[model samples]
Target: MDRRALPDDDTVATALALALRAPSRGNSQPWRWQITPNSMHLYLDRSRSRPVIAGEERDVLLGCGAVLHHLSVAFAALGWATIVHRMPNPDDDDHLAAVTAVPRRPTNQDIAMSAAITRRRSDRRLYSDWTAPPGYLGLLTERAAALGAMIRLLRDRSGGSRAFEPRPTTQGWAADSAFGSPGPYDLENAAAYWTTSTHSEHAPAGSAAADEIAEPDHADLLLLATPNDDRLAHLRAGEAMSAVLLTATNIGLATCPLSAPLDSADQRLRLRHDALDDTAHPQVILRVGQAPDATDLPPLTPRRSLAEILSPVHA
Candidate 1:
C-alpha cells in the first residue's frame, strides 16, 4: 500500500501568507500563524500589542481578530474549511484562535471576501459629501449584528451630534489621547506609516495639516457599538468592523475608522446620552462615503519579526 501524503509546507505557507494580509491597526501586522496538519493556530504577537491605548488587552485582541477574519475567508478560498476557537485557553499568554481544518467547498461570499482582503485599506480621506444608500446601512448593521454587536449611525444633525463616543479611563490622559497625537498611537509598527506621512514634503501643519493631508471633513460617518464593554466584546467588534469594511470595499465605497470622536470623554458622555440605551460602550466610529480620490497616510511602521513575536514552547 502506498503511504498517504501530508499537506506540503509550501501549500501551508501560501495559504497563511494570503491570510496574513489582513489590515491591522496601522499595518503593524501583529499576528502569527502556526500551521499543523489538523489545524492552524492564530497567535497574538506580544510585540505588536498596544496596552496603553487598548487598555486591558482589548485592542490587541481586536487586532488579532482581524487576522482571524482574514484567515477564515482565505481558508474558504483554498477549499479548506476552518472552525475558529477564540482564546481557547484564558491562561495562555498570546494564543488567539485555533483554526481546525475541514474539507469543504467555497461559496460566492467566501470568494468575494477573499478577493477583497488585499484591496481593502483604511481610507483616511474625506468623502465627496455623498450619502450612503439606504440599504447599505442595513447591510452593515446586519453584519455587526451577526457578531452580536450593533451599528448605529451618528448622523451630523442640525444641532451637532455626538453618538459614537469613547471614554478614556486610563491614567495620564484626558480622553481621546489617541486622537490627540495626529497619528496611529499605540500601533506597534506604525513608524513607517507615521514617519513617512509626517516627513512628506507635501504634508501640512498642525491639526489642519493632518486633515489637509488626509482630506478630512467630508465622509459620512457611522458608529459601531456593542453591549457589555469588555475585552472579548471589543474583539468581536473588531471582527464585525473588518467584515463591514470588507463589504464596503467590495462595493467600491471608501471607508475610514474615526475613533477620534469616540475617544473623547465629553463626546462619549454626550453620545451615550443621545445614542445608546444608557448601557452601551462605543467601540469604533467609521466614516463611509463616496470619494473619487481617497487619500491615505503611508503605513511605514516597523513590526516585530515573526521570530521575535513567536516563541515555540510546544513540547
Candidate 2:
C-alpha cells in the first residue's frame, strides 16, 4: 500500500476522508481537508466552533490537531511522504496547518496506525479485567512523550479504582464533570453537529449501584499533560493525543479520552501532585483496554461537506 502505486486523485481523496474521521471534542468534526495534486491541506473551520467546553479554542485546535496526525499516518501507509507545517499563521487563527504529501516507503508504524483506523471507536462501556502486556504500556508513554505530552497509565487493581473519580458535590456538579469530560461523546451534541440522523438512540439510566458494580478494567489510563499550559501547548498536545489514540486503535485496543477531571482544578489536583499550573495542564486523559466484545461503533462519523468547510478566501 504505497502512495506512488496509487497516484490516482480518488485514492488520495479517500485516504484523506478516512483521516478526517478522527474523533473530536463534542464530535464537532472541526476539521477540513483540501486535496491538491501535490498536497493535502487540513484546516480548522472556526465557524463551527463549540462555545461552551472549548471556550478558549484550545479544544477546537486540539481536535483538528488530532486529525492532522491521523492524516499523516493514513497517507504514509498509502506510501505518501507526509510533511506537516503546523500553525502556519499567528494572525489567521483558523488556519491550523498544511500537510504536504510525498511518496515514500511506508514504515511498520505507519501500517499499524493506518490499519487501526477501521477498528478505533470511543467505547463508554466498562472494560474486562484484562491487562495490557507490560512493554506495550511503556511504549504508549514514550509515544506521548515524543509529542510534548505525558501519559499517566492507571494501574490495574480490583475495582479498577484508579479510573477517573467524579466529584461528590451536588448532583449537577457531578453530572457536569461526567458529561463534560472529553471521553464521552453524547448523542445530543452529535445530532446538532451533523445535519441529519435517523433517530436518537437511548439507553437505560444507570443507578449509583450499577455504576459502582461496573468497574472499569481498562488496560491503562493515560493523561495527556504538557510542559507549558498555554494555547500553543494545548494544540500540540491535541495533535499528539490523536497519534496515541490512532496508534492504539491500529494495535487492537479500545480507547476513551476523558477531559473532565483535567478541566477541574480540584479533580486535577487530586490526580496530579501539583495543581494546574506551569508544570502540567491536563488536555486529555485516556482510558485504553480490550473491549468486552468487538464494537460495532460506526467506522467513521460524518463530516461537513468539503465545500462548507473550505473557503474561497483560502483558495
Candidate 3:
C-alpha cells in the first residue's frame, strides 16, 4: 500500500466525524478512536459505557462495531480499501478493532452506502400501515449474511406477534406492565407510555394522543442474531446491523433498532427459545417498514464531536 494513498489527518478526522453518527443505545456513544498516520484504532470507552442498560458491554461493543463498519464504508467512498482486524489486542480487552485504509477504486455500492450512512436514523416514530415490498426482507437478510450475521424476519402471521409478549411473572408489575396483568399489548403500551413521558414537553397541546399510536400492523420485526454469544459475535452483529440499516435507508425504508426487549438475561433466553427457537442468539431487534406519507421525520440524534471521540497516537 502506498503511504501517499492513506488519508491525511484532516480527511481521517472527517471520516471519524461521520462514523460517530452510528447509532448507540440511549445515545451513550461509548467509543474512542486513536489515529496514527496509516491506520485507526477503535476502543471501547469504558467511561461512557452504560452498565445499567448494557450489561457486560454487549451493546457497547455492538455500537463500536457499527462505527467500525461506518468508517470502512466512509473510506471506501473516498477511494480507499479498509482491512479490519477484530479484537486485535487480546491483552487489552478495551481494544475492539484496528482498521488500515489503502487506496482502491471505489465501487458504486461503496458510494451509495456511504451516502446512506447520513440518511439512516433510528426513527422510533410509528411506521405507516404500508407493508414492505415483496423480497425486500430477503435482500436485508442477504446483506447481513455477507457480513457474518443472520437476520430473521418475524411477521404477524408467523407467530412473530407473540414473540414480544411479556413473560408471565410471579411478582410485581408482571415484569413488563406498570400495573395489571401483562399481555401482548403490555410491551406496546409501555413503549407508548415512555415515549409520551419523554417527549411530552416538545409535544403540542392535545397532541399527546399522537404518541399513542400502536406498533404498526404492517411493519415486520427483524431479529439480528449470531451463532455464538460472545464479544466477537456481538461485534459482527453490530457490523451487520450497520449494513442492514444503511441498506434500508438507501432503499427508502423506515427503521428503528430496538435493544430494550433483549437487555435482560431472561428476555434474551425467552427470545432465543420462544422467538428464534434456539436457532441463534438474538442481539437486537429492528422494527422496519415504510414511513407515513407527508409526515415530518424526527431530527437526527445528537452525536459527540470528533474531538471528543478521537485522540492522536504517538508512534
Q: Give the per-residue lDDT of model 3 (tens digit) for 224-275.
A: 8989899999889889999999999888887777665565689789878977
Which candidate tops lDDT? 3
Measured by C-alpha RMSD in angstroms, how accurate is candidate 1? Answer: 6.2
Tens digits of per-residue lDDT, candidate 1, 1-315, equal 623222355655555665565556655566776655566677777676555344556556667776677667777877777777777778985777777766688889888878877776565534465655668878888887887778887744221344432333333232333444334332222311121222234233454335544433444457777886776776677788778878887777776664434444566566666787676777767666676564553343343444443345465
List the candidate numbers ranked by TM-score, top first.
3, 2, 1
Ranking the candidates on lDDT from highest down gives 3, 2, 1
RMSD of each: 6.2, 7.0, 6.0
TM-score of each: 0.75, 0.78, 0.82
lDDT at 43, model 1:
79
**How many backbone collisions does model 3 have?**
0
User: For model 1, where is the 10-residue window of minimal lDDT?
Assistant: 190-199
Query: What overall lDDT, based on C-alpha atoms, would model 2 receive against the true structure?
Result: 0.61
lDDT string for model 2 (169-262, tens) is 3432445444432223321132110000100111113633223333445445566778876767877887788878876776677777665444
Clashing pairs in 1: 127-219, 166-262, 189-301, 190-301, 191-301, 192-300, 192-301, 193-298, 193-300, 193-301
